[model samples]
Target: MATKTRVPQTIDAYLAGLEDPTVRKTLGALRTQLRKLLPKATESISYRMPTFKVDGDAVAGFAFFKNHCGYYPFSGSVVPALKSELDGYATSKSGVTFPPDQPLPAKLVKTLVQARLAEIAARGKKPAAAKRKAPVGRPATTGFRVGVVRTLPMTAPELWDWVTTRPERWLGPGATLKAEPGGQYEVPKRRGSPGVRGEVRVVKPGHRLRMTWQPDGWKKPATLQLTVMPKAKGASLHVHMEKLPDAEAREAMRERWSKVLARVA
Candidate 1:
């Protein structure tokens, strides 16, 4: 007869059942941090993970996997808000993953919890939306910003080289990126007329890069940030460009980045 695996009914049982000592210790530390951050938050097994709830809302959760551990914020927007701080970890819209041996810092975990708390508090102040259904393929627009995220099959270092060396793949033909703070780059005029130019503002090789982007006709440059996050399988590339002129520009950039990601994938 086959034996059934016991489900953990409590956080303690979940930690106790973990076979890997590193995973156990890592999750144990994470639990301690969450408890300290949310002293009054209730704990339980929610969605098969150790969850922390505040005011009946699932604010945080943690789980161990075969090769990595995950910290779920239980909110779609939190991870993206903290993407800059989460350079070395794997992140989706809802969760961030770190190596079992290298747990997230206490400060970072506190920031995550605080962000969720603030989000919940803000939501409480706002009026609820109507019962009408929403449209599909709706673009997330905030001041004409465009953000795109894609998980690719390559590692962080591999992606860093692939993108930095092949600037034309996304930027344009005859484009260049020096990949250093204050380094200048340009995209030349190809078929018609105008070109684009900018300077790199920040660079963390194989992890993150930030720069300015201005076309020939634009008066002000937009800010562009690209982050490569490590994952259990490969890595995720996040392309965020802001200060676009309008929704049309935002949608166009979104589609452009989507195509870039698909090509890389």
Candidate 2:
């Protein structure tokens, strides 16, 4: 008869079972930091991982995998909300994964925890009028939209490859686009200039794409959409952007996308 293996039932037991010293030390430190940051949170093993719960809600958790370690906020929105800050890490809708040798930074961990707590607090409540105002230099959460469309001399596959392979052409120099939902992209700041960061929200290979777009220093992201369709002559490229701060921004992006489309054409 084969013997049954035991599973860890506590955080300490989980740590003790880790055979790799690097992973053990890294995750142990993370546990300590999580406890400190979430002093009021109840700690226990949930879903086979070490989890922290607040007010009967699981707010955070962590577990080790074959190639990486993961940090879960237990909220689908938290990871996406902080996509700009999480450029170098691998993220899914539910968790962020990092190398076992590199623990998540304390500042980043704190920010993640705060975002989760704020989300929990905001539930079942309405915001005051004052709280509805956009952060400085940001557009209101609703209103102000612009779009531009152009027909190009290429097939849908050719256009998709052109755009996805060389996203920096439109996204800015040094930009990267993963071209899949929940995948992240960023154009790093350089020489005192601002850069862009965001995550893909939708993707329909060779057909359509939608993403959140936010430049450096913006408090919230705006939405950007791109669509490709087969045309009688060639293919059509449509660019739509929303959540502009004012008429000036609307016109600016309108011109920008128009120029980009012209270049593509």
Candidate 3:
């Protein structure tokens, strides 16, 4: 069984769930920095995590996990722009993970935020022929339905266990799963009901697990993979889903899966 951590209903609730005093302080500082950078940005919880928006677009987000913390600038562009200054940190094109005890430098954080702002502000300057799809909130075709990665303060083995075993604390009564390749993963559609069926295509204990995930309306199953990697603090949980039928399906399931992933974590 995994430790029981309360799900925050709001951004305040989410911040309050930060058990470490230092974590709470660091996140508070980061939030303050974000506000100063984007004074007009609104605060909201997108993808079940705390996020800040500017002009109705997501500018940044931050979250605390078991071992470390994460900061997302909502674009791959920002990471590369500041990559030189981010050496000695684990960074991907999307975001970076830093030790919670020692948050990323204030200057670097500011630079990352500034890069994102410049990217957003410069959008209007692009030539009509060179314009890319509209930003997330606008009307533009998107690449994937949803793509996200989260880090936690737990070892790979622990995260692997948590991912394989689930409780009905949130969605339903309980869940049934196996920790092997070509295994079964069934959960109740509702409390006290028969489980919706699914199968695991690949399982590497404590490292990676790929499974078939079928939602309620699906004509066929789309593949969902959970890759767990060791982190300085605990582990990094990477999730990807594909074969969504349409943009509507992707948008709908993106929210639903966001909630489900938080719980499964």
Candidate 4:
């Protein structure tokens, strides 16, 4: 059955009605920051989501979901300009998706709004490129790079728990998963360098998990997928990481993933 989308009469009610405590906290932080950042902007519920309007025009809006959350720039062009700062999250021309509990950084949000406002401010004397016809859809910027397979003597459920709970188990105390799409899948940093800080892209329990993997000094954000296929006896673990920058990077990932996959034994 399709889940019903409740159109909250107000943004407060929408945030209040959120069943997930983590989501409530995340949205609360975002709401507070948005209000502070755009004090002059009026708040209203639009299209069944929280929208902030300025000068009688909608500049931005945000919505929540079970696995992830996204923000609207009120325009497609705004996102592309701020892509570099939006690392570790999935983004589209229209908006950006961050982990449900990992609301966007206040600075990034400010930048996004600033970019949109600038774009709006320059509406006159349009550039020649702006005058030309644009493409139908956004190009796919995310891609695959390396994959490694391993047959584990563990059930799918066990494998799921093992991988998702790795940070807490391996990193030590005070560690826990953000537990939502776009949530943190951060590995502990090391040697004064960011070791393996990434974001969880997808989490299908006992079956599949995906995320972005940008090691400390990588040039681009690579993708990672961990799949658990239940076999008759145990299960097979397929670990794939992609979008590596070059052959050298691919080789490094192959070595890295190979070592990680070795743990499956």
Q: Of the candidates shown, which would achieve the greatest lDDT relative to the real structure?
A: 1
Better TM-score candidate (1, 3):
1
Q: Please list the residue runs of candidate 3 whose C-alpha ends up more than 4 Å from where it truly belongs after superposition.
A: 1-7, 125-265
Clashing pairs in 3: 66-153, 67-153
lDDT of each: 0.79, 0.78, 0.68, 0.69
Q: In candidate 2, which residue ranges exceed 4 Å CA deviation?
A: 1-5, 124-265
Candidate 1's C-alpha lDDT? 0.79
Clashing pairs in 4: 99-182, 144-242, 144-243, 145-242, 145-243
TM-scores, one per candidate:
0.51, 0.48, 0.46, 0.46
Off by over 4 Å in 4: 1-5, 124-265
What is the lDDT for 226 in model 2? 77
C-alpha lDDT of candidate 3 relative to the true structure: 0.68
Clashes of each: 0, 0, 2, 5
**Whose TM-score is higher: candidate 2's or candidate 3's?**
2
Q: After superposition, how far is residue 243 of candidate 4 from its true place, in Å?
A: 32
Residues 95-165, candidate 4, lDDT per residue (tens digit)? 89888757788878866765555444333223557556445564333243445555578888887788677
Judging by lDDT, tell me the better candidate of 1 and 2. Answer: 1
Q: Positional deviation of 98 in candidate 4, in angstroms?
A: 0.9
Q: Give the per-residue lDDT of model 3 (tens digit) for 1-265.
A: 8998666777788888888999998888888888866677899988767999977879899998788889999987568545557888998888889987898787888667655654454343335753454575664432333443455677888877777774243224656777587788766677433345578877666766666767666677766666665655666565555566776766665566557657655
Tens-digit lDDT string for candidate 2 (1-265): 9998687888889999999999999999999998877777898999889999987888889999887999999986678756667999999989999999889999889668766765554331225665566487764354466656666898888888887788988777788889888999898887755888899987878877778888877787887877775655676676766676677766767678878878767
> What's the TM for model 2?
0.48
Residue-wise C-alpha lDDT for candidate 1, range 1-265, written one tens digit per residue: 9999777999999999999998999999899988866778899999899999987999999998789899999988778766667888889999999899999998788667756664554334223442123355663332466566666998888988887788887788888888788998899987864688999987777877778888888888877777776655787677877778877766667677779888879
